[model samples]
Target: MSDHHIIDAKKMMITLEDVNKWYGQFHVLKNINLRVKPGERIVLCGPSGSGKSTTIRCINHLEEHQQGRIVVDGTELNDDLRNIERVRTEVGMVFQHFNLFPHLTVLQNCTLAPCWVRKMPKKEAEELAMHYLKRVRIAEHAHKFPGQLSGGQQQRVAIARSLCMKPKIMLFDEPTSALDPEMVKEVLDTMIGLAEEGMTMLCVTHEMGFARTVADRVILWIAGKSSKKRHRWSSSPHRNQQGPGSFYLR
Candidate 1:
């Protein structure tokens, strides 16, 4: 519980300052810095291996940064297990693949985390899970196994599962990449609805159409670093002057 503020911690939901990471001898992230305000939707886009996924991964301490600071909801990340757990409780993540339990039904999968991690009662967790499932339009399939659902439906379930935690910030690491072409839109539509509701999100994706529709800012990650050029669509009247794909440099 480090109270030391890096950048008006009261106003920013997430802050990463001079963050750096390495895998063995290879430097995976270089001096990464970012600040996200509550309710802001940010898109991180770039080619493969550009550190887009790594950045969001570090936020929740899934992949710890070897250097610099990461603060989420005023909790600075460190070796302190309590601080890490606190941040994880406030941030929910949706991955590229739908990592659901094959043995559990959709409702069960969604309720497990809340029951175990959040110490919620089983009945209460199930109620919360169903609330989010309906929000994602997948409540009717709540009793189905993950394998029984379509890719889009499962991904929507994944999103709902994350929402069950009642997180203040959501991180999406190319959530639609593993979906079929026809399924991508359904997942994106669910995400768009989340954006409209003012959920604070940081997403990594190449879907320019989704970015154009919901992103308050688009950041380009290149070669382990975020590009200097950023597109701030919310305040820029010329945001649409160029095509969606033209917003970020390749």
Candidate 2:
């Protein structure tokens, strides 16, 4: 057990080195460098214009970087399609809008990639799908479509969909920002359960309470470039942090 925890601490899953991103001339991330350990829950907070979401998107190449490099699960993000495909498969992502295939049933949404991309048998893929659905507390909704569920339930299905890919790391871009007040807890509870099960997660959110309670490290991104300087947020010791227009981690 001791060795297990140690392994979790020492395992490095994602590394960003001097990463800079620009939308034409508007530079988003400025020389950003971050290293995340396996099983570490990282929360990123900032104002709306800040590059928090952009940084998370860069990890999965959802938004291609204008400069620097991102490495996930030991493979570098390069021009090679194989490398991109491999990194994407290992790094699962959950969007705020719960981008599900409303036309397909939940079971189809979960098993499609595994059966096609991983080339697993349908029965085997479904077993994995059912396991993750249970993990996210949405097993009973398996046959339903995305439109048939509540926002929170849809998000849970989205999470289960990601887990179907069997990722080594999970990246959440504002997981709960879009839900109603009451639905937030369900999504949070799902995340907490995953944390307890030892999944590595990096999130971009403004929910200070969730960050303080569940995060091992807090990363803050500046709203934009600062006097042409880059601000770096790292994994700090468990200390309470707060700021005016600044991202805090507890």
Candidate 3:
């Protein structure tokens, strides 16, 4: 954990107790449990089909579990629409595909959620959007369409778009999986900047360097369950572990 990071054991921001899920009899997640404190960064890494992505999706209620409890920022994930909306609003998510509106300009894409969901004024939303865009060093491309930007630039815009919501917890699901190798660093850099500011984040990526540098805790998932949890950067077993076909991020 970074010395500057704030983690309150008493103030839990996210909790998953005895969580279990299935895909029509195919057990995807079993007895999974987790807890996340505010301002703490966690890297969830494992090979494909390890249920890493499903776990985060459950946090936002994007993928519902068949059993167990999930609570975010003190709000329990249940059938209530109000609670679901609150969780979604408080937790921002960035995906591997850079899910941006094709016809919308970068500025418009960032401002859309705030204007529609938060009901902010157009000018105010645009201002907030530009603030984050500049933070990610993409203000110059704010007027461009998603197709016009490189993969890295698009992913940064996705990050900026998520930040515009002012979320309490940010969830990244394989954020760099789709980018070119050369372009991956830019997106990782933007995330690193967010980490330095003490943003509470849970990232699902194979970027072990990012994990080592910014992660307060690293969770490894295997066979639908959390296999291990490591505390402290120097203690990460993955630091000396890397190779193709060895179950590292691929």
Question: Which candidate has the highest TM-score of all?
Answer: 1
Overall local distance difference test of candidate 1: 0.89
Candidate 2 yields a Cα-based lDDT of 0.81
Superposed Cα deviation of residue 215, candidate 3 (Å): 0.3
Model 2 lDDT per residue over 107-153, tens place: 99999999999999999999999999998898999999999999999
Against the reference, the lDDT scores of all candidates come to 0.89, 0.81, 0.87
User: What 10-residue stretch in candidate 3 is worst by lDDT?
Assistant: 241-250
**Per model, how many backbone clashes are there?**
0, 0, 0
Error of 3 at 121 (Å): 0.1
lDDT of 3 at 113: 97
Please tell me which model should have the higher TM-score, number 1 or number 2: 1
**Shift in Å, residue 239, candidate 3:** 12
Q: TM-score of every model? A: 0.91, 0.86, 0.89
lDDT score, candidate 3, position 50: 88
Poorest 10 consecutive residues of model 2 by lDDT? 225-234
In angstroms, give how far residue 197 of model 2 lies from its true place.
1.4
Residue-wise lDDT of candidate 1 within 113-221, one digit each (tens)? 9999999999999999999999999999999999999999999999999999999999999999998999999999999999989999999998988888887778888
